[model samples]
Target: MDSIDLEVLHACDQWLRAGWRCEYVTVVRTWGSSPRPEGATMAIRADGVVVGSVSGGCIEDDLIAAVRENGIVRTAPEVITYGISADEAHRFGLPCGGTIQLVVEPLGAHSRMDELLALAQRRVLTRRTLDLTTGAVELAQGQADEQLRMDGQALVTIHGPRLRMLIIGAGQLSQFLAQIAVGLEYQVTVCDPREEYRASWSLPGVEVVHAMPDDLVLEMKLDSRSAVIALTHDPKLDDLALMEALKTDAFYVGAIGSRANNARRRERLREFDLTEDQIAKLHGPIGLYIGSKTPYEIAVSILAELTAVKNGVALPAQMSVEHGKALAA
Candidate 1:
């Protein structure tokens, strides 16, 4: 399913097109294990209708009620917080007594949402800085270093680009990986030079590139939020592009092969002048050790490991392989 923020952003764009006054309410910060992350958002209408959510259903319902009852619906742009105490948590469905801050800004023709949409479309890393004092918004170049100022007032927020992935092959495994990646909001691109594989490839919502893998990686300028996975297992095709991707800041670069083949791939990369650390980042035997036998099962394993590394989590040596199959059996 599309994320709440993405859905709200889509609704906001539609509202703008229809010329209705709308406000974008974003969850800027959370004190504890909140329902959503820092960039969570909801779009509210003048009539108190809301789409998307910053918390569980209760908090969204309260926000909707606030629009209908509170006078701020007609007054100005502002920020609000909820679930600060045990009572408030009970009322808002926050499991652990926590709080979440939201930034509610009335939408306008000059809200810079077009830029945000454009950045999201291209999967470019864009950072938006909101000046609470002046209520001004600034779009930065990228998302590496961001500063938020919540000091005393309501909230200061930043929205970073969604992580992206580029799979160098359009095989069955790539199809499975692409589908899962899209659900996770990764803009997926599949590259394949082999006509045999590219011709039979068919998957919705994934970009199919017929260019040479190395050229595609270079042209795309794989950035830090990007990931490159080689699924073809063909050295001539996969290794050429891997050499180029390793030089870039792509967060995760991996290939599918056996443990012995992984060793060989490392030796080849080292010969290409990739430093020890750079070559070490390449995750081969790509998936966690789930004993995956089928292409789909293997894809799940690879994506699980990818997610772990992406979130800066240390995954166990054994992969999560029991997703399918009869657990009772």
Candidate 2:
């Protein structure tokens, strides 16, 4: 499972390449209340096929109808608003009389949709610029500020960064962990150089890498939105990667271990010339203290904690195994 945004973009690219006319709808902005966020997208093919979503299913039907009846194929890239009033909200099934703004553009034919999709497929962040005048699209590689504009449109759309996750082991636990991570909008990779563990590893969409963990970390070039999790408890496998991770802006760096082991691990990292600031970024005893007894339960606990941290929630020390260790005896 690739990230949702990636999957959607991929589907859009595939639809375009199939020689079918496609409408790419992106939610640029909303007011009052909306089912989806500003960056939400939905792609519709000529046969009324839809992948992804902007508003709820109700709004999608209307868009499909427009594509089929009103010759929306010729509409070009334009901003459209819907459900701004109470009556309109009920008609469109938008909860709380909310308003949604959609920027609909055609796929294929000299547009940068395929290029942007390819960039995202390769785990690269590319910005797409839309010409409000002639409905032209250009893919911007490298770094530049995002810009959006639509001709007499309701919202400006800017496709943002892609999501990424690095799973530092190829084990049963890593398999479950990778699936959950992938479902939650992450481009997941499972890394393990040990052939014994690597031989059993099989995941459909996840990238499996056989490399030294630390070297792989360096090669990944993880950024702030990226995450690294060490499911392998061996210091030889996990420690060097974690040491490199803590030094980077990767938002989350965690390793699975017991309380005392995590403490010892931190002390071991201290010997590596890691400063207090760098060490502080490590998240060991890695899952929420949910008393998980099975791999599935443990995966849930880890994912829950990851989401909390991703959303900027402060983690409580009481959830650490150190706080609950007295009972584990």
Candidate 3:
């Protein structure tokens, strides 16, 4: 789960503890353009206050009004569908026939929210299975490949940050990358063996480690959901990390440099035990062709590529900065 969903859960727990009634609303399915994705959650109190979002603003507003006017009287979980017809779609402010299905469960004793929050805080991915009939929740360990699913009888939602990132630098670019990665709900760790860089690294939510990049990569046991981005521009620090990262199931391995520099880096990696296929996986001159110059812009460009890779979207060669510049020249 991302930070927003976590916040909603925390709010629900607090409200329940305070003797206030609130209903937890989750998007189970969406059709057409949706402001929020499936598994997105919102907690609405009886007084119309809310945490998180379902359909940007309009759907949330409708939810608040309904809760305030009728009260959260549901003893069991219920599925609600919005934007069924063209008129209803316009009334709900849904874009062009967009429809959303939600599961709303009133806060009660069988919620098991405290355990779920604790598991999430521990960085453990958990599967929360909710029985729609009895409003009973069951918690269990979830795999990285699992996703949210709802059958006729129950709804299962995966909670916790499934994406992990190993940033091989603690410099300015890494600072922006790590901060944004945190907002994107990536469990980020910055590894810089140098004392000077490690001393000044002070990002609050990210973990800063004083270990060799390769050693950290080995210890992390990176999997398919993991990403490794080298921003130090130091071969000694970045190359070994790339070597280990390329050998793993990591979905993305990138390095920041010019095209020529990356070419040289690839030649250098050839001297290692890496096979040609593994070496081909390196994404140097990383990020999309946005002509980004500032640290934040560069970070955004980098994440744009990462997000594309994560979503399995392919960008053509002409879209790359180097290729575009060459064509222009």
Candidate 4:
């Protein structure tokens, strides 16, 4: 789930707790060139205050206007469509005659938003099923592969972390990377056996553990939705973890090092039981070639490559740090 949508849910929870009526809006479907994707959410307070966004801006303005004019009168969830006509598209600032279908539900105690927020905070994947007829909701454990679905009867939405990241160090670079990963909605865990490093690291919303990298790797049981990044240059720390992670279904397994160092690391991994194809999956010289000289910039470069891989974008060879640096040399 997006952090923005989570914030929207949090705001709705607060409003309901304070006895303020609010409407929860979700973008169920989109046609043509819409600004927000399906499953994007927004919350509108009774006084027209809003959090999160379903469109660029104009659609939000219209929704707020309606709420302020008549108040939230609906006792049941309603499906509303915006930008049906070209004129309406232009008025709503939807580009290229885009259309957005939304489920606008009047939120109250029955909304279960507080419970949903708690589950999300706990990093539990949850499915929220809303009965369109009765405004009732049911929550269940959600699968990582599940997507948002809506029928004539109900709306099913998945929430919580859909991706997981394991960073094998508590160094400064690891700290920056972990923080950015959290904002990107990844369930981030940092493992560092070195007590000195772990003692100095205190970032919130990220799980820090005092365990060896390889042990943690096996314990995580990394799946296709998981990523492992080794920032600790120590072979004893990073190499074994990379070895175990490469054997798994992890989507991205990488280590941060120079070209020569990574070559040596690969040679060292050959001493392990990892197959050639599995070792080949390692992304050493980990990030894109962004000329990153600082910790934050390096973190950005690494995440850029990770995002590209996640989206199945095939970047050119020259974009890699090794390739680009070689060309520069």
Candidate 5:
């Protein structure tokens, strides 16, 4: 599954190629609590077909109505604001009287959307700059830490893989996790040195590597945007990979196992050079407590925890399998 941004870009690409007039709308800024972030985007064809979203369904309806009425006749880009008043906020369904600023650009040859889409498909971090007056665009390599910025003359939006996940083991659980993670826009890679497991693995879009987990983890240079999950249930594979992963800035490092096994794993890690703080970062038994008994359900539980961490949501102690089990004891 494509990310929301990718979906919009792809819809624009198709509409443009089909000779349909289209307008690209991006959220440039927002005040108070908005449903979507500043860089969220959507594209509308002249026929009122919309892909992606801005302020959920409310703002999208307005944009679609505008496109149907005016047909995106503007030759240049323009900035528009919505929900400026309490009544307007209520009408637009913005929570807490939120305000949202948008950049509505009529698509044309100068958009350079093809180049942007290609870069995004390649998972390359790209900075796209759009001139507000001329509608001309410029593309350059972007840093992971770069953010969306708008000056009086232009809008610069960063595109590419903002998150990644490395799954240690191409087993059934990894397959389900990779599928969901892809929809979440994670550049997923599943590493398994075992040939038998690697041969049967057939998920598309996820990279399958036949290398040691530890070496793969180091090679990827795991950063804050990265996550590592061990599902192999093999000490030789998971322990080595986690040893290196915990030392890095990967936002989450987890291994699927029982609470007692996790404790044992920590003890074994202490046998190595890992410190207590680093060891504490490990998420063992690895998922939220949702009474998951099947592989797919377990994958959902794991992703729920991963998503909570990614969004910086604080999960109640009883929500976690390990913590809940402990509390029950």
Candidate 6:
């Protein structure tokens, strides 16, 4: 599935190609408890059709009403702010008197949206800079760590996957996990050397490779924005990847197993060249303990913990499988 931002871009491209006036709106800044974070986008056609969101509903409603009445009359990009006052905050439905700043750009040939869409579809990280004084846009290669920035002259936005996930197995659990990860806008790759498993693995938008997990881990050169998950439950396959993954800067490295198996796995990792902190980075027993039994439920549980870690949310010990189960016992 395409991300909301990508979908907005696609809609803008289609609208422009169809000879319809459209405007691309982006949330550049937010204050207090805003509904959406910076970089959230929406595309509005002259007929008041929209494909994405900037706030809960009130903001979109106002934008749509304006477009329907004024018919996208703007010829150049303009910045607008909402919810700056207490009454305005309540009117826009911004919680806690939140304020949001947006740049609404009139889409045309000079927008370079088609090129941005093409690059985004190919999963190429791109930085799109839009001149505030003029409608001209420039596209360049962007790093994974780049964030959206706006100054007096231009607004720069980063597109494509900013996070990646490497699953060390192509099993049923991995299939579910990979699907969810893709929907979360993560570039997901599954590596398994076993022919029997890899032969049947087929998922669109996810790259599957027939290589040893450990070798693939080394090849990826995982960074802090990357995650590694081992669901094969085979020590030979999972352990090999875990050892290499733990040594990298991957923010999350987890394996699926029981408490006893995870303990044994940790003990085994001590024999490797990994440091104590690196070994401690491994998240075994894989997921938050939500009493998940089926593969789909387990996948949800795993993603919950992964998301928490990614967002820097420190989940309580009782939320883990090992700790929760032990408390129950």
TM-score, one value per model: 0.85, 0.85, 0.88, 0.83, 0.80, 0.82
Please give the lDDT score at residue 221 for candidate 4.
86
Q: What is the C-alpha RMSD of each candidate to the true structure, in Å?
A: 4.3, 3.2, 2.6, 3.1, 3.4, 3.3
Instruction: Output the worst ten-in-a-row residue range by lDDT, candidate 5.
Output: 320-329
Runs of candidate 5 exceeding 4 Å displacement: 14-20, 170-172, 192-212, 215-223, 247-249, 270-280, 289-297, 313-321
lDDT by residue for model 5 (1-329), tens: 57788889999888888898999999999999898998999998998999988986999999888778877788999999988999999989998669999999999778988788888887788999999989999999998778899999999999886588999999888999998898778889999999999998777888999999999999999888899999999999999999999999999999999999998999999998999999999998899998888998999999999999987899888899998777767
The local lDDT score (0 to 100) that residue 29 gets in candidate 3 is 98
lDDT of 4: 0.93
CA deviation > 4 Å runs, candidate 2 = 108-110, 141-161, 316-329
lDDT per residue (tens digit) for residues 19-120 in model 6: 999999999999999999999999999999999999999999999999988898998999999999999999999986699999999999999899999997
lDDT of 1: 0.77
Which residue pairs in model 6 clash with each other? none
Against the true structure, whose TM-score is highest?
3
Q: lDDT winner between 1 and 3, please give it.
A: 3
Error of 4 at 158 (Å): 1.7
| Runs in model 1 lying further than 4 Å from the true structure | 1-7, 68-74, 119-124, 147-149, 153-156, 315-329
lDDT, candidate 4, 196-215, per-residue tens:
89998879889999998999
The alpha-carbon lDDT assigned to residue 300 of candidate 6 equals: 98
Model 2 lDDT at residue 252: 90
Clashes of 5: 0
So what's the TM-score on candidate 5? 0.80
Any runs in candidate 3 off by more than 4 Å, and if so which?
198-204
lDDT of 2 by residue, 99-135 (tens): 9988787766766677787676665656676775567
Candidate 1, residues 1-329, lDDT tens digits: the string is 34455567677887887887778887777888788877778888767778877887888888778777763343345777888888988889887768888878877666677777777666655666665554566776765656455654334445555677999998888998898888887888999988888898767778898899999999988887899999988998899899999999998999987666877988888888778888878888787666678878888889888888887898654442322222323
lDDT of each: 0.77, 0.80, 0.90, 0.93, 0.91, 0.92
Query: Alpha-carbon error at 23 in model 1, in Å?
Result: 1.6
